[model samples]
Target: MGKVTGFLEHQRVKETYQPAEARLRHYQEFVSTLPVLDARTQAARCMDCGIPFCNNGCPVNNIIPDFNDLVYRDDWKSAIDVLHSTNNFPEFTGRICPAPCEAACTLNFNNEPVGIKSIERSIIDRAWEEGWVVPQPPAVNTGRRVAVIGSGPAGLAAAQQLARAGHDVTVFEKNDRVGGLLRYGIPDFKLEKTSIDRRVRQMEQEGVTFRTGVLVGDWPVGSRVGNLSTETVSPERLRTEFDAVLLAGGAEQPRDLPVPGRELDGVHFAMEFLPQQNRVNAGDRLERQIHAAGKHVIVIGGGDTGSDCMGTSHRHGAASVTQFELLPQPPEQEHKPLSWPYWPQKLRTSSSHEEGGAREFAIGTKEFIGENGRVTGIRTVRLAWEGGRMTEVEGSEQVLPADLVLLAMGFVSPVGSVLEAFGVARDPRGNAQASTEEEGGYVTNVPGVFAAGDMRRGQSLVVWAIREGRQAARAVDEFLMGQSALPR
Candidate 1:
């Protein structure tokens, strides 16, 4: 512990967000990392608890306390090393992750938790500025080639690790651009594209090759999943060439609302609306786009995707925006006694929520109302929950006016085209069936084929994706060389 009484002496400080009015004018990151002095002060607040739960709380198991102590002692170089030992991309997690680690901090049992995310962001930023981040190519090539599908965080992490372990690595991206979901699914307002580009550059120097505009298997025709492939590669080709193949593609099949007027012109999936703006921001000239400008927008499913829709609608100068959630609202404050050192269900207000929007809870969309082959409004009903079962409240049905509707419900599973092409078995939830056991883990039914990230475990966080990617790299390395020194 840097300061034994630090928790009692200091207060938790958060990263600063640009004013909502100014931030809404453009599609760029609005949050500013904490200053070095404030970051050190925040780091001093880590407790000398017997066990550090923040490590287990994080999906990648980041060394939270060690880095916290390093930042407090002004040893930034050591902090970055500790951070990179476990996590490959601190920048991504620092900017977008919900930071479950903070929720599990010992100080959070009573006092505000240390600003671990902000400190993490500061450490990496300083490392990049000082040019400490560099490529570490393998000393000797093993002549073993590994093919990675998808250029998202998981694929990138696995590719980088395999390259460092002396395997010839190549990543195939279906879209015209790399970064997968980070390039298209997430908006630039939360994370600028340059953040991903620099990391890609570093990975390239580490001997990992990226081939964009290439699809590995068939994509469902007219599917809402983003696709900009200029070429398609058969699964047989990869098996014949590469020693191992890792499926790291995302779970992109967005959950749909199959109501009466679902086919209306103005209704669309959240992926359909979010990706266009990202492409436009990247300077691509789209012939047509799903714009929210000058329209009344209704976003169904009150999760992160719904919040993103609301934010983008604000940027588009929509007339009004409303969000709906089927479940009841969670309490603003969590009960520490019951949820200590664990992720608790509570209301989380994002930066977009601060900009503007109406949030409706315990409400379900019954039908889509439209005229002239376009959406005009939505029919909704309030509900009550008893004994964990929901019952619709009588006489509480109403219509909410809208010009556009976006289904922002979470993803159900990975798009199955690639799995089908490779003849891989799927779990009950439609994700690739692969265990996480110590032996023969991350391997599919097909020899030399492995699965990880959302493709294997279904939709999850970026940190989880990185963890799976790293572990899968180790699994592939062992399969290729009979053993590996890479961390699992």
Candidate 2:
């Protein structure tokens, strides 16, 4: 610990952000960094908890207390080294992760966590500014070849780890550019593409080869990854060319609302809308862009993806924006005493919601009302939960004007064709079947084939994806070389 009584002497402070009105005008990151002195002061707030629940709370098991002490002691370089010892990308997690570690902080018993996420962001940002971040290429080659499919966090993480382990790693992405969802799914204001570009460059320096615009399955794909490519590489080729193959493809099947008027022109998936804006922000020419200008928009789903759509719509100057959630609204604050260590269920009003958008909960969309093949409005009904089931309330049906409707209900599973193409069995939930046990974890049904990340575990957070990828890389290395040094 930096100081025995530091926690008692300091109070928690977080990073600041630009005014909502100003930030909504452009798709650039607006969060300002905490000053060095203030960051050290905040770092001092970390209590010397004997158990350190933050480690268990974090999916990547970041060394929270050690790094906090390092920051408090002004050991900036060592602090970042400690941060990267576990997490492959602190910048990505710092900006986007919900920071479950903070929730698990012992100080959270009183509802004021140690501000772990902010501290993390400060350390990594400082490292980059000071040029402490650099690539570490392996000294010797293992002569083993590995192919990682998907190019998302999981795939990227696995490829980087394997390459560092002295294996030849190649990542295949269906998109035209690298970074997978980091490149296209997330909006620019939250995490700029530069962060991803920097990491990709570092990975390349570490000897990982990235191949974009290469689909790993059949033609006429229905998902976004499929739409990015004109041709697909058969699984047979992958199996023959690479010593081991890891399927890190994300869950691309979007959950759809198959109500009437689903085929209307103005109705689109959140994926369809989110990626176009990202491409435009990257200076790509979109002949026909999806915009919410002068139109009333309704986004069905209240998750991060939905909020992203809300933010993007505001940037497009939508006439009005409304978001609906089928589940009832959670409490404004979590019951902290009862949920100190677990992820709490509470009202999470994102920055996008603050920008300008009406949000409704416990409402079910009934039908899409359209005119001349375009969506015009949405009919909905109020719902109540009873006996753990949601039932619509009588005499509570309503209609809202909507020019564009986005379905952000989350993903169902990976595309079946890709899984089938590899002849890999899937779990009951339709994900690639892979265990996490020492004996068979991450190994798929087919020999020399593995799976990880959202493709194997279903939709999850970026931190979890990184963990899966790192672990999967170890598994692949072990399979190919009969031994491995990569961390699990």
Candidate 3:
């Protein structure tokens, strides 16, 4: 505790954002950092709970209380050290994570959780500015080689840890550049590419070899979601060359809405539309770029991916935008008494929602109405929940004009080709079958083969991916050697 009664004396404060009008004009980060003094005050608001649920709430199990105290005392270097001890990339989580930690805070029982997210962001930003973040090269070589597929958060975390453990680590990515989804799936407005590039540079210094445009699976050009093809690399070559192989490819099998007129020209998946904009933002020439200008856009699904499409459409000057959700709208506020210290079911209005968009809840799409094979409108019907089952209400049908339709419903599972090629057993849910127990954890049916992150588990947050990667690395280290010193 930096201050004994700081939590009682101070109130929680969050970081501010730039004006909507100004921020929408460019694909750059718009979040403004809090003043140093204000950040310290916010950090001081962390109470001394007998049990810190915030630590438990965090997927990476970050030492929240210790970092909060360090920030409160202006020991930013030490704060970043504590944060990096658990999380490999605090900047990424600080910006994009939903911060379940706040919900698990003791104060959240009254809906007044401490500003853990903002304090975390501040600690990392200060660390970078002060040049405290550096590479940690291994002191000795283990004379072993490991191959990691996919350069996303999970793959990067595993590769870095294995490299620091004196194992030769190599990352293979299909994209021309590293960062599988973070490079293309996300927009620059939320996270700039420089953050990834900087870390890549550091990882290089740490002796991690990254081979971009080296696809490990057999896929044709323009077939791997958004006209990006994988670089040809045989699985036989990897197995023969590396001591161990870890598959960290994310769950990329997007759930498609295969309804009437689904093959229309104007209708596309969120993955197709999102990656094009990301490529353009990265200064690549995109032939026949998809734009929402002067069009009435309807985004199907009401999750983070859908919100991202809404924001991108607004930036493209869409004449009108609407988001649809099949489920009923949750209450604006959750009953804290009933859902204390756990993620509650509540209405979440994202920053993109604040910009502009019509949100429809309890509505189900009946069909996609089109003209001459181009999407023109969407026919929908109101829905009601009865006995835990949803049913369409008769005589509540309507049609909304839509020049463009984007399917933003989440992903189903990882692409089966890679897993099948490797002959790894899959769970009932279509993910790689692997336990997290101490024995046989993260080990695939194939010897010397391990799985982690979205590839092993289903779709999840970036923080969870990092945690899985770290744990998987430890498992691999233990399997290679009798005992390991890596953190789990």
Candidate 4:
């Protein structure tokens, strides 16, 4: 700890955001990082508990206390070193991660936790500015080649670790650009593309090859999700050429509402709507897009993707925006006593929620009403929950006007075709079948094939994806070399 009584002396500080009105006008990042002094004060609030549940709370298992203390002492170089020891991409997590580490802080037992996410962002930002972030190319090439199937955080993290461990690594992204969902799925306002591009440059310098617009296996035909691949490489070719193959592709199959009007013209998946704007922002002109401008938009499923749809709609000057959640609203405040050292369910109001949109809870859409084959309204009903069972409230059906409807429900699994192409086993939940605790962790039933990240764990946070990637790299390194210096 920087001060003997720093936690008692300072209150938790949050990063300031640009006004909703101002931020809604553009798609650039709006949240400002804390100044150095304020960030130090925030770091001082870390109790550096004896157990440090924050380490386990974070998916990457970052050395939280050490970095916090370093930041408090103004030793940013050491802070970045501590941060990089476990995490390959703090900037990605610092911006978008929900910060489970903060929730697990012992301070949350009675008071606000340390601003770990903001302090983390500060450290990485300063490191990038001071040129501390550089390619760590392996001193000697082990001459083992590994092929990573996705360019998301998981694949990127694994590729970096494998490269550093002297393996020749190549990442295949089906999309036209690197960074997979990070470059396409996430809105630019929350994370700029430059954040990902800079890392790609570094990874290239580290001797990792990136093949964009290239698919490693057959993509599902007629699929609307992530269908930008122009070239295909059979898994057989990859297996024959590479020493090991890692499946780090994300779960891209968005869940659907199989209701009466799901096939209506205006009804679309959130993945369909969100990526178009991201492409437009990247200077790619789409002749036609799922435009929300001057239209009544109803986003079903209250999650990050839904919030992203709402924010994009706002930027598109939609006439109105509304979001729906099937479950009843969570409590406004978390009961820290029972939930201490673990994540608690509570209402989270994102910056997009503050951008002027109505939210409906405990409601389910029954059908989409349309006119001339275009969605004109939606039929919805309120729900009543008891004893973990859900029932529709009687006489609760109502019609709400909508020109565009986005299904923001979560993903169910990775594309089945990709897994089938490689003959990798899938779990009961449709994710790739693999074990993390057993020997040869991350290995699939098929030899030389491994799975990690969302492809193995289903939908998850970026931090979790990175963790899976790093751990999977260790497993692959071990399999290849009979021993691995890579940390799990």
Candidate 5:
């Protein structure tokens, strides 16, 4: 809108990255933000499309066109204002979000879309550098006390919103640090913990209390693998003390590969392996921390988590890295006509994939080969789909060397104990049962109890989690005060 023919004049400019070899030496953010003029040019590329699909494409419904125009007009302050108006944390999404908004951009019908993600990163980074980002404490106290379970993006967003509504908000986290997966599960190469710390400080100034390393329910039994809770607080205590409780614990129960030799050592869940390295990077000393140094590593599941593992393994000086996907490899590109205005299925090669690794698709693992109680390799078989059934290809069985096997098959559900303690119902897919309706939305079966984010909707993007948290804050506010002014 700032320039009538800006899209035609400028091609999309992407952020530059540090050489993979140089970045692999340490765990730090490697992607460089766009220059100011470049960001402005990208923002200028936002055409005056009558219908702004980018807004709806974004899970948080960010005012994309407004921010783009503001940035293009050299009004960085207003750009950040419009940005923070919707997204509680743009830095996280700007760095990691797949940018479905760009996919839905009208210009993307034929030409390259506006570099929205790069511009977003530039605006927020500038805001922080210029001291434009600061605490916005509420004007008055509402005298309501709210408890938010978990300190991931979802919980943090809800806490900030609820606190701004003049409520006494407290967040509970099972990890030693405030951020849940952001501080542990994710590699520092994408998002540094310092970014999370800055927001945590702002939230504290806004009257939000954080209780870390405290489990809000019974400790998950039988699996000490991923449990980070050191202290326990009974669900009854929270129910009796707080006016309302919001369950925002993320889906943490990782799906497992239960083939033969799964019990062997060195075959670990992605959660277990990832958190260990993250802790190490944070300067925590752990004896026998998992490492990929000089070992043939096989990462199962070709998702973001698997990519993260691949990157981490590369940092660990892995001998060789290989990834596996059960499904057939997707096409290199999508047909725009059929998939316009929505996320498309195509071959996605992450920065980690670009670093170095072998990717095997349409292959299934038959068994794990081990020696002396340790995994040594994996037996695989090629597959073909016929009539909705997978048929093994004859004479296609093979064994691959694997000193370490990381299962990054995504999470199945939240730790059941926490939900069971609150007596929250679960959906067929095992996510916390709740709705997003305006009336009694996010409310669980139990009175004064609500759920949001990954807990309520299952594992999803950080943007979606932030959206759920903000909306659920409004729902909780309405439940306690009978009405709320917070945005959905």
Candidate 6:
């Protein structure tokens, strides 16, 4: 602990952001960093708890208390080293992760967590500026080859770990660029593509080969999600060419709102709309692009993706924005005494929500109203939950004007064709079937093939994906060499 009474001496300080009006004008990161002095002061607030719940709260089990002490002691280099010890991408998580670690903070009993996320973001940003982060190429090659499918967080984390362990690692991405969802699905404002590009460069220098626009399994010809690859590499080729294969392809199957008029032209999946803006920002030319300009937009779903859609639409000059949630709105604050050491149920108002929008909870869409094949409005009904079941309320029918509708419902599973091509069995929920147990962790039914991340664990946070990737890398290394030095 930095100071025995630091928690009482200091209060949590949050990262600041540009004014909503100014940030809405461009798709660039607007969150400002805390000054070095303030960061240290905040870090000093970490308590000397006998059992640090923050460590357990983090998916990758980041050594939170140690790093906090390091930062508070002005040991900048060591602070970053401690931060990087567990998390492969603190910058990514710092900006986008919900910071479950803070929720699990020992101080959260009173609802004021240690501002761990802000400190994490500060450490990484300063580390980059100070030139501390660099490639760590292995001293000797193990002569083992590994192929990682999907370039998302999980795949990237696995490939980086495997390469550092002296294995030849190659990552295959269907998109034209690296950084899976980091590259395209997330808006540039939250996480810039340059961050990913810089990391890719470092990975390349560390001997990780990336092959973009190369599909590793059977994707139906001409079928496209956010983006598609023209070239296809069969699963057999990968299984034969590489000693081991790890599938980290994320769940891409979006759940559809199957109400009436679902086939209208203006209705689109959130992925479809999110990636186009990213592509356009990257200087790629799309003959046609989805726009919210001068349109009243309705985003269905109340999760992070829906918030993203809300932000993007505002950037596109949408006339109005509204978000709908099927479940009732949670309380404004969590019952801290009962939920001190876990993620609590409560209302979450994102920065995007503060920008501008209306949010309706306990509501369900009844139908899409369209005019000449284009969505014009949405009909909805109020819902009441009784004994864990939702039932429609009488005399609650309503219709709202909607020039554009984006379905932000979460994904269900990985694409069936991709899994089928590898002949990897899937769990009942449609994720690649695999266990996280020590004896046979991440191993698919097929020999020499493993699965991790959303492909195996279903849709989850980026932090969880990194954890899965790191663990899976150890599993693969052990399977190939009978023992491994890689961290789980």
Q: Per-residue CA lDDT of candidate 4, range 447-468, in tens?
A: 9999999999999999999999
Cα deviation at 193, candidate 2, in Å, is 0.5
TM-score of 3: 0.98
Off by over 4 Å in 5: 219-229
Q: Locate the minimum summed-lDDT window of 10 residues in model 1.
A: 220-229
For residues 1-488, could you state the per-residue lDDT of candidate 6 as single tens digits? 76778889888888889999999999999999888998999998899888999999999999999988998898989999998889889999999999999999998888488999999999999999999999999999999999999999999999999999999999998889999988889999999988898899999999999998887777666645444545788999998899999999989999999999999999999998999999999999998899999999999999999999999999999999999999999999999889889999999999999999899999999999999999999999999998899999999999999999999989999988888998999899999999997595999999999999999999999999999999999999999999998877
Q: Per-residue lDDT tens digits of candidate 1, residues 1-488?
A: 55779998999888888999999999999999889999999999998987999999999999999999999999999999999999999999998898999999999999899889999999999999999999888999999999999999999999999999999999999887889889998999988999999999999998999998787876444333244526778899999999999999999989999988899999999999999999999999888799999999999988888999999999999999999999999999999989988999999898889999899999988899999999999999999988999999999999999899999999999988899999999999999998997495999999999999999999899999999999999999999999999998
**Could you tell me the lDDT of residue 244 within candidate 1?**
95
The lDDT values for all models are 0.92, 0.91, 0.89, 0.93, 0.92, 0.92
* Cα distance off (Å), candidate 4, residue 458: 0.5
Where is the poorest 10-residue window by lDDT in model 5?
220-229
The alpha-carbon root-mean-square deviation between model 6 and the true structure, to one decimal in Å, is: 1.2
Model 5, residue 468: distance off in Å is: 0.2
lDDT of 5 at 236: 93
Taking all chains together, each candidate's TM-score versus the true structure is 0.98, 0.97, 0.98, 0.98, 0.98, 0.98
Candidate 2 global CA lDDT score: 0.91
- For model 5, the local distance difference test gives 0.92
Better of 3 and 4 by lDDT: 4
RMSD of each: 1.6, 1.6, 1.4, 1.5, 1.6, 1.2
Cα error, candidate 1, residue 132 (Å): 0.9
The residue-by-residue lDDT of candidate 5 on 1-488, one tens digit each, is 65778988888888999999899999999999999999988988899889999999999999999999999999999999999999999999999899999999988888888888999999999999999999999999999999999999999999999999999999998778889888888899999999999999999999999988787776554223244437778899998899999999999989998899999999999988998998888888888888999999999999999999999999999999999998889999888889888988899999999999899998999999999999999999999987768889999999999999999999999889899988999999898899886476999988999999999999899999999999999999999999999997
